[model samples]
Target chain A: MQVPAPFDYKRASTLAEAIALLRECGPDSRVIAGGHSLLPMMKLRLARPEVLIDINHLSELDYIKVDGNTLKIGAMVRHVTLQKSHLAAEYYPIFAEAEEQIADPLVRNRGTVGGSLCQADPAEDLSAVFSALKADILIAGSYGTRKLPISEFHTGPYTTALNPDEILTEIDVPLRSNTGSAYEKVERRVGDWAIAAVGTMVRVDDGLISEAGIGLTAVRADHFRAKEAEDSLLGRSPSTEAIAEAASLAARHCNPFADQRGPEDYKRHLVEELAKRALSRALNRSLPEVH
Target chain B: MRVNMSVNGVEVSDEIEPRLLLVHFLRENLRLTGTHWGCDTSNCGTCTVLMDGMPVKSCTVLAAMASGSQITTVEGLGANGELDPVQQGFIEMHGLQCGFCTSGMMLSARWLLDHNPNPSEKEIREAISGQICRCTGYENIVRSIKWAAAHSQNSGVQQGVEA
Candidate 1:
């Protein structure tokens, strides 16, 4: 039977209390929201934190709303909420799409967006989706709150830029008009981690691509994004040829490792194919049909 | 730590270790073995139970985190010694062969039918996709959930008999 090693558990009633607990528990402590990712790791002895501060009772950090031109999502928002949120689907379809593919419904009910992003698994879907949207993450520490671009959030696999005493509070996604996004993933089975997944967002203006964002997962795209591909799509029409070129650039840039999921070359192929499919769908949504 | 929670509508309190999983808390501590534990990882949904009316894999949840929540196991599905519609439907449709996955499947079906009275075949399949039945009796399971959806309004007093 798999079980976590004995540790002290602390439940924080408020955000301030949670922060204080984190500081008091010191560096060997960790904050748990959903505990889906953390508990499993604990069982395997992969993550042996001396103290676990449960933040589920902090209802203040569970929300999805619009503030001016930005869509703000609280860190404690569960994956099920994101998947079922009509507002999320309307503004960022990639979130709903990716949330649907994250684990299963049972897991989604308890798994929080904050935990997923903080876990920083290379195969995690939300990281790619947020990376494509160029979202900013809000972190709170004893000192104060700080915002970090999603690109700089992940320092490495299973790691984040968050300090030991800090907690990620919210995600800020800049809303854009005439923008459409889509996520495409290829998993071996239902609820499995992606072999390779791509999330694409496009902003079309006057029949030209004003801006584009391409994010890849599992295939290990640098910073979870394809900067060269995104740059190539800028100022270009969303034609099949232009999209193919950008997709090729995206495939060439990612560094996938060979594993039980697939070989490195197969993952590279999936990156190219999924990127093309995601870009096509995103462009279709951004531009009105001529016919 | 001292944990207090409602299980099957009964208020219970106990002193438990922080590392104790909810599945163990239910099975060993509370002696509610109806909620089966399978594939300690969250992949298999056999350990599923209703927490605040939503289905959650109990194996992945710490008992400490569920201290104040209301949990409904398969044993709580029926009241006054009557079977829940889901339990009756499982018998009527032969939803189980080995019956290892029956409890979790029935609880999930009950939650789904409560939220969506009439789910399509695809929806029912999707609802139980997290559960793994080695007997490969998913067709009967789908039919069982559909049967429950149809008979949900009826008072389910009939005794459940395996087919």
Candidate 2:
């Protein structure tokens, strides 16, 4: 019984054509890649764009490759591709681990990585995974291309730093040699959104943790991360006490809202517990002896 | 807008609205009601179909996006009036009680067996996790997929298109 409001549709053969369509259609327009996230919202009357520019044919933007030291992932890369990228898994196991837990196989087959990131749903798994990896986003506009750190990409839930004429073309994940990342999530059912989840990347040298990145989702973590917690981990030994302190700090700062998922206290507890588990797994991955 | 796509291996062209969902286009426009409509939110896989040989929820995809793609619906599962191994497996394993989720489940199983000739019970379960059988018929569904996986080699008429 649900359907989108009547709108004009244009399929963009190239990125330039897509940008021009966006500009010509004005701000009332939206470009759809996979349309998994956008279409559902369109049906609910939550998003009412006057024009829809389809960018599915832009194959130039669908790729996963290594460019120097960064693993460059195209915006048009589908979720299934991201999940199966052995190159990405070699660099960051978090990519495959998180992709497996996002939605379902059918949904993932059509959902593009760019569409998921652009949708900017607070509970989306990849956003947290990207935040944990400190990935950079590339945006293209009529003027030219500009780069923004993924930290500054999401302005708020369901919103981003993208202008009307801008399109996210690629994501740059800096590959590290001695680093490991993992994601831990707890959902009520199969393919459901996380009630509370944590993604962390740890770079350990000798016995000291050189860098730590902790990203939380659904618990309302600021910028989808626990900066205070990550800061506490700087140059600290990968000891149980150090990890527990960071985990506790991560759980303390997050402000979770209650819904059918659970109460706030339960989510906060999950943040702390899941953070501890993910951090432990990442730390172990970084150190082969204990792994 | 006018859309042209191969449906069940048939070349079909139709004039349709841009907002039309693939599920509606298949059912109302093409009269391919074998692809059911359930939980329009796209969470339920009742409207699942193969796009370029991969399973996708048709409700979430715009018909415009499927213009150049090859779509295989439930009606296309069998070849030359013979049931696909998946369909036969469904019957052999008693996969359906209410049969509401059968079409989508069978299509997903067909896709799985096409890519992976033999899938374990866990893999079969994962392939159809997006679908919901209100009848709670998962046990039989898993058995049905395993049957298809076992029978896939013997019965090779190919899937999707006859061509």
Candidate 3:
């Protein structure tokens, strides 16, 4: 009985073709690739467009390549691909870890990195990983392509800066040498959305933290970098006391609501637990010889 | 929409509604009832199938998206009438009770073995984490996958190591 809303379907061979279709369909079109996120929404009647622009066949967009000092993940790269790619595991371990943790294996085989971001769900695991990695998202629209920092992409819960005509092209994650990153999530059950999630990336130089970034999800409108917590840990060793205090600061800064997953108190507790665990794991992996 | 694809090793094409799901196409159009539709949502892997040798949730994929791809359903799993090794393992290990989740479970296990071949117990669990089965408690299912993984590795499939 599950069926998508009636819509004309078209397969686009290239970005230009896709954009042309989008432009032609105007506001009644929706682009779907690896519909782990979008298809379910459509079946649930939450999203019903008159045209479905199928872009999964655009094989050019399904790639993971090293470009200079950053790793470029194609927008169509499925979650399963990210989880299994050795390139991703080496360069962006946190993202790979988080990608593996998203949904189940079946969904991963069909869900995509771009769809997760474009969906802009506050509880999505990959969104927090993108924020913590400070990745750049490439957007291709009818006009031209533009890059936006991950932090600026998601403006609110279920909302993004992407225009209706624009399609997410790729994600660029910087290759951090001698850095450790970890993604820890607290969910109601395995393969479920995170009730509250934390992504921690730390670069430790000679036992001292050099650069640090923290991303939180499900506690705010969208995944956001915890600037206050990052500031507190930037120049310090990840001592248990220091990490605890930093995590507390993160918990304080987040504005979480009482959702079906848990209440605000429980969610705040999850932040502390996840933040502490993620920071410690990242720090442990950041040792010069860990790689 | 008109879709033409190889389903269960058979070349077929049919006129379908634009909203028809790949699961429905396989079940209703091809009459491959072995592919059961469990939870229509992407959460349950009851209608899992291999699209170009990769396992995908059939419930979530539109039939229109599968115009040129190769689809392998549970009915296409075994060679001839013999049970596939993964299916055999499930039977020997008593992996199913009610059997509602069997097709998806077997397909997921095949995907895991074809890719990993020798997965650890944790990996086996994680591989089929998307599949939900309320019967047989999953202990036997995980055991069956682990059993098949060990035997499949010995059967000559290469196990790629993760760095």
Which candidate leads in DockQ?
2
Error of 2 at A140 (Å): 0.4
Each candidate's B-chain TM-score, in sequence, is 0.93, 0.92, 0.91
Candidate 3 docking classification: medium
- A best-first ranking of the candidates according to their DockQ comes to 2, 1, 3
Lowest summed lDDT over 10 consecutive residues: which window, candidate 2 chain A? A282-291
| Predicted structure 1, TM vs. truth | 0.97
In model 3, pairs of residues that clash are: none
Model 2 ranges off by over 4 Å: B154-163
Lowest-sum lDDT 10-residue window in model 1 chain A? A282-291
Candidates 1 and 3, the one with greater lDDT: 1
Candidate 3 segments whose C-alpha is farther than 4 A from its true place = A205-208, A221-223, B146-163
B27 Cα displacement, candidate 3 (Å) = 0.9
lDDT (Cα, tens digit) per residue for candidate 1, span A1-291:
999999999999999999999999999999999999999999999999999999999899999999999999999999999999998888989988888888999999999999999999988999999999999999999999999999999999999999998999999999998888999999998879999999999999998999899989998888899999999999998799999999999999999999999899999999999999999999988865641
Alpha-carbon error at A35 in model 3, in Å? 0.9
lDDT of 2 by residue, A1-291 (tens): 999999999999999999999999999999999999999999999999999999999999999999999999999999999999999999898999899999999999989999999999999988899999999999999999999999999999999999999999999998876788999999998779999989999999877898888988888888899999999999999888998999999999999999999999999999999999999899889976665
Question: lDDT per residue, candidate 2, B1-163, as tens digits?
Answer: 9999999889999999999999999999999999999999988899999999999999999998899889999999888889998999999999998888889999999988888776777888889999999775699889888888777754332332233
